[model samples]
Target chain A: MKPRVLAGLLTLALVPAAAGAASLGLGVYGGMSSPILNDTAGNGPQYGVRAPVTLAPMLIVEPFYAQSALGDVDQSFGGSSYTRSGPDVKMFGANAVFSFGEGVKFYPLVGIGSTKITQSGWADITDTSLNFGLGFGFRPMAKLCVDVRGELNAVVTGDTSRKFGNLTAGVSYALFGSE
Target chain B: MKNLRLILPSLLLTGLMASGCWLISGQFTVSQDLPTPLDVDSQIVIVGAHIDLNTQSTYRDHKNDLKDLADCALLGTFTNTGTGTLDILVYMTPAGSPLHSTKVQLDADATKIKVWGPLTLGPGASKKVGWDESAGLFNADGKQALLKEVKGDGDFALYAVGASAPYKLRLTDGVAVVVVDAGK
Candidate 1:
């Protein structure tokens, strides 16, 4: 897991030198993530931060961290009953972005990352997964851009194939080059 | 036409976002072993003990809504550690204290309502005993009569009964496991 996370970070570090980035930016966002299947669990809130490095007008690499809260569930076996709290999920990874427009950008991205899931009465589940998504970013003012995104993360595991949907909205502050 | 193509994907993404918990989080059937009062391994019990079901993380906010509890299971297993064969039973305790936790002798109390079983166990043996009518783990779909005894933060009493096992006195280890399918 350490190797994989390190590899992701290395990819972020090395992409700029290989492609020649035009700008560097920092982003923060928050929204709700619900079970994609609809039958399993309810929607929960999520928040995240990211560093987006533009390698070209159409290309960027983003390294990010997202934290989420999940809803609880209940069960009963005849006389015995229980309520299991929803697990909290934390993810760290990077995405390769392909931007479509300038100033107001429509981008689709794909990448991989590691995830850790935990709950009160259950054992923690940690795995790496591939995630892909789309985003629309526009500057409401100079040096600040409003960002909105929707993504699906497929957690890698041998036991069960798990995935989640995340939708977030926030702002990106320019660190250098472009806002 | 170009803008429409761009808007279409965002619309589709929004539709997926609104549709479901597509995040196939690998949360599976979670099972937890509950703790009992006077909880100890190989505890001696001729009478009964309150297996506290209230100590876990239960949702207090939406506890009243029945939909929140529709999909789940509770499983129980007990072991007899004595040298002789023994008979054991789970009974619903009287109303005030719990749905089922009697301090005194089980049979001596007139109001005891039987929940689980008079499961016979050989010396150093264990078996599954829940609301189900099965040989192994309980897959009971029908609610038990004493289901209300542990509906919400309630508990029941399990004790060795009958004269077949040394005046109903037996050294035993018992645990009830509550399981809920996260996939549902």
Candidate 2:
């Protein structure tokens, strides 16, 4: 099936599920992301928004949109130095989060999504990839939750691929449920 | 509960597989300086002159068509030949008028030819400078102003003012009458 059709179907399925979920949480997050592959010196800030739907006592599905700022990289080739400024990236994806415990819960998430990178003086590149992450969340008050996560995203285009790691912190409001 | 245990392990395995280097595309580099031979103090002379026509075209329905673009570039090369450094101001004025009277001092060695600069020389040094014909002349404020296009054929003169030790040097080259005949 076409990726767009599959994405549309997933969105349709989520609407009903989210409407009947036990709770929904909306949050904003900011973080640092670093390239793990070639020329790893280009690291930048990433910020995003996410909405989480609690389907059952320990199961949650979250969809997110995140963007990374333009990063500058200095490279030396053949004894000459050149500066590369950009390749800012944007990611849109959804994850199935599995919560292990209450109050302070540890969750492992598996996700899939698309990423687009735009660099100055070069054509833009877009690809789809799989995401993996581990996070911990704590609720100190009834409506307030704080979470931290470490995530890895593997982006694949044709036969080549690259990976990026993100360490993020977020705050969420319960909106409609108890933690 | 049994299903949960199985699903958790499977998810963990997928996560591990997905976590690794894989998230960038092509990189582009912008070149700031051109590669030219560096020589010591050499006689400052105009080596070449030409009018470059900038052209463009597009492809449509398996056919390529040219676009109407009249931009051109004025190119020249200046060579310096002296044991001592020579501070010079090289500029272009309307073919017959006195070189723009605005005199600016050269403060640094690497100043752009668009402004007054110290062109240091040891024994042989040369540099190539060019201006976009459409950019017109440099104003008193050291900024490009008076945008003008080359019309048919016109004559433009190149002049250089330099000071080396006891003697001040001023040299003017024959007028360069640029014939704007782009692509017959």
Total clashing residue pairs per candidate?
Answer: 18, 18
lDDT of 1 by residue, A1-179 (tens): 36256547656665644445567788898999875532234578999898877766676667788888877654553345434466688888777777888778898877667788765523456776567789998988777889788988766443233567888898887788874
Task: Give a tens-digit lDDT track for model 2, residues B18-137.
Answer: 643223332111111111322212233221112211211111110111111111222234455554456644444433223233233221223223422344433345543323221132
Candidate 2 chain A, poorest ten consecutive residues by summed lDDT: A75-84
DockQ for all candidate structures vs. native: 0.06, 0.06
CA lDDT of each candidate?
Answer: 0.55, 0.51
- For candidate 1, lDDT tens digit of each residue in B1-184? 2453344346545634553443432332322343432222223344455555445444222223212112232345556655777765444553434322323344467766654445677777765543222212222322243335444444555443533424333322234443222221
Cα TM-score of candidate 1: 0.52
The candidates score, on chain A by TM-score, as follows 0.85, 0.91
TM-scores for candidates 1 onward, in order: 0.52, 0.52
Query: Could you give the TM-score of chain B for each candidate, in order?
Result: 0.47, 0.29
lDDT string, candidate 2, A78-176, tens digits: 234334453688877777788898679999888766787775422356766567899999987887789999998766654345567899999887689
